[model samples]
Target: VNIDYLKKHADELKRVAASVLTGTVTASLLINKLQSYPRQNNLMYVLQSYGQLVKTIFICKYLLQLPLRHRINTQLNKGEQLHNLRVYLWFGGDGIIRKKQEKQQQVTARCLNLLTNIVMVWNTVYIQEILKQLQKEGYQVDEKDLEHISPAPFEHINRLGKYDFNDEIRLQENGLRALRPPVDKR
Candidate 1:
């Protein structure tokens, strides 16, 4: 990272940033224009150096900060769990998106997202109810325990398009299924 070059072009950097923030210019358009330049653009070079400096600082902090690294790993694991759920749900077509057109592909992706969100909502609701039930039963339910729970679990979900509209399925007054009793650890 060329700190001196960035300092020299500080005003230019601010002007470009202002243009981006004010919507006078778009970042993609600026990148495209910069890339098209026959010779290396001075502002572009300065921006690249600035980006490298920011990246280096982040790498240093990520290496030194244990909490930050743990948080990042936790987030990454959760994301991977969600992706796994998506893959599990994509049972149709053998987990392959066969859509050829861009619009169709986008629609497929949106539909998958909607299904994932629906499953997440269902899991969240059930988890909250379970927590309440446990608390009511004189169990020590901690917030720390709740923090480790993810809404991405799909083990109980039947993804085979099975339909059972029987009234017995809705045993609770709230129209949700009755909460299952906690199993004994022993």
Candidate 2:
């Protein structure tokens, strides 16, 4: 994240990391480490390379995860929002992602996540007003509680759409032909 420090030590760090690389390794997965005890014959090269390999492994693990630290935190925050989204999706006492096949279920879940996010963004103003009123009344709520996600509030949405996955859905103008739009949101 700090460009100045990266610029100054970039070459130095690269050199140090390179210098840590050990004995020549072949393509297949495992690396057989050869080391000798004090009583063993001359195998100094193998012994020294074993130690270097361990050190390199440790260094690479640490560096590999360093750049992902922020992304991991963001994932943690998004996880909390999933709880509320699940509650909304549980309209029929279960979410729409109850498929037996793991792959199919994953696809269903991702679609639901996107749909939920869209609904929350569309109702941003309504959600903000609620949060503002709570704050004015001296509630001790965190601003994060009013992030770009809201509970599923589609009172007019048809929860009884064809339950059978094999049935083709009727549509008109790219919208569900059998469903009714909410006459009023209030």
State TM-scores per candidate.
0.83, 0.29
Which stretches of candidate 1 lie above 4 Å from their native place?
A: 134-147, 171-175
Candidate 1 residue pairs that clash: none
True-structure Cα RMSD, model 1: 2.5
Compared with the true structure, what per-residue lDDT tens digits does model 2 show for residues 18-88? 54454234322212322324444323333344456667876677578974554555556566655655566
- Tens-place lDDT per residue, model 1, 53-123, is 99999999999999899878888888998999999888888777898999999999899999999999999
Cα deviation of 60, candidate 1, in Å:
0.4
Task: Report the poorest 10 consecutive residues by lDDT, candidate 2.
Answer: 27-36
TM-score of 2: 0.29
Error of 1 at 123 (Å): 1.4
